[model samples]
Target: MLLTLLWTLQGWVYLAVVFDLYSRRVVGWHMDRKMETSLISRALMMAINLRKPPPGLMHHSDRGSQYASNQYQAMLKQHDLVCSMSRKGNCWDNSSTERFFSSLKREWLTGNLYSTRESAIADVRAYIAYYNARRLHTTLGDMTPIEFEKIA
Candidate 1:
């Protein structure tokens, strides 16, 4: 999923994120001034490097051009991941990731004015840590994502 942030100086910053569906943890993410294939590709690379998921792991995404680019598709093929795209005009297929972005903006970014992109990036990075390590999820038996992963 992608998120947009506005700072006082810069017009907009874009964030690309990859979430672990099982644990609801943010496995990979990247922020940039421009939304491009490279942005999402870097995020995917981070997830691939960190998790090293087995072959045939499903890679689900929206019908964004970035996700559909040749480079991105090649990466998925190289990793042996099965690609899955949501139906056109359907957001529900990616609701879990959408919910995460909603929580991020509502819980952490609301009423905050960032002076620089760097500051916003730092704040988002912190929120990711808290989301995985501290925020409780009722779906996970009132445990944080990290705790849920540990137990599972």
Candidate 2:
């Protein structure tokens, strides 16, 4: 998903986030002034480095141009990740990512605008930390992602 920041000196900063479904955690993210294929690729690389899932791991996303690009597809193949795209016009297929974006805006970025891309990055970094380590999730039986992982 893309998080757009307006009113910055550089015009717009876009954030690409990769959410892990098992623990509902944001395993990877990248922010830049442009929404390019490299942005998504970088985010996926972060997740791959962090989790290092086994071969044939399933990666699902909407049919965004960035995800559909040849470069992005090549990266997936290199990592032995199988790609799964949501059916056209179906939002429910990626509800976990959608919910994360909703919570990010409502709980972390509501009514506030960052003056710089650096500040936005800091804010998002802090929120992801809190969301993973402190915030309770009903889906995880009211435990945080880190906590659930520890016990699982």
Candidate 3:
């Protein structure tokens, strides 16, 4: 998942993407007010409600404060999900996340104007649905994320 580090830019939206470990499918995502515990929590909730991963599933992310918060960790524990965090300040540990954000910015953010956070939230919801269900991934043999999962 990503909390777009656009603090210097115009928007104040927090974006999160949930990628499957095996297929690299972005199974879930959301845009919200801030990079709070709730933001990541909602993203996890979407992934849980969608994929329904087995217990003790592992979720990896960068060592951002949003992911490191006690509330977030507690939620992960509740779901029996193991927490894996990247080392501080290192980008490669979460390179896939970086790539996802780059694609989102290049493919969507640059082409759209969301004057309000609510607008961005709504658009992100639709975009992520398309990303998971329709957008073909070259890495997944040109299959959409959900399709790749089905085949796998």
The models' CA-based lDDT, in order, is 0.88, 0.83, 0.77
Clashes in candidate 1: how many?
0
Per-candidate RMSD vs. true structure? 1.2, 1.6, 2.3
The runs of at least 3 residues in candidate 1 whose Cα sits more than 4 Å from the true structure, single-residue gaps closed, are 1-8
- By lDDT: ranked, best first: 1, 2, 3
In terms of TM-score, the best-performing candidate is 1
Instruction: Please provide, for model 1 over 1-152, each residue's C-alpha lDDT reduced to its tens digit, 9 standing for 90 to 100.
Output: 44444554666888889899999999999998988998898988989998999999999999888888899899999999999999999989888898998899899999998888899999999999999999999989999999999989
Q: Give the TM-score (vs. native) of candidate 3.
A: 0.87
Q: Candidate 3, residues 1-152: lDDT per residue as tens digits?
A: 66674322346777887888677777767666676788788888988898887888989988888888999999889988899988777788788778877877778667676677777777767766777788888888998878887888
Candidate 3, 13: how far from true, in Å?
Answer: 1.2
Error of 2 at 41 (Å): 0.6
* Whole-model alpha-carbon lDDT for candidate 1: 0.88
RMSD of 2: 1.6
Model 3 regions more than 4 Å off: 5-11
What would the TM-scores of all predictions be? 0.96, 0.93, 0.87
lDDT of 3: 0.77
By lDDT, the best candidate is 1
lDDT: worst 10-residue window of model 1 = 1-10
Ranked candidates, highest TM-score first: 1, 2, 3
Number of clashing pairs per prediction, in order? 0, 0, 0
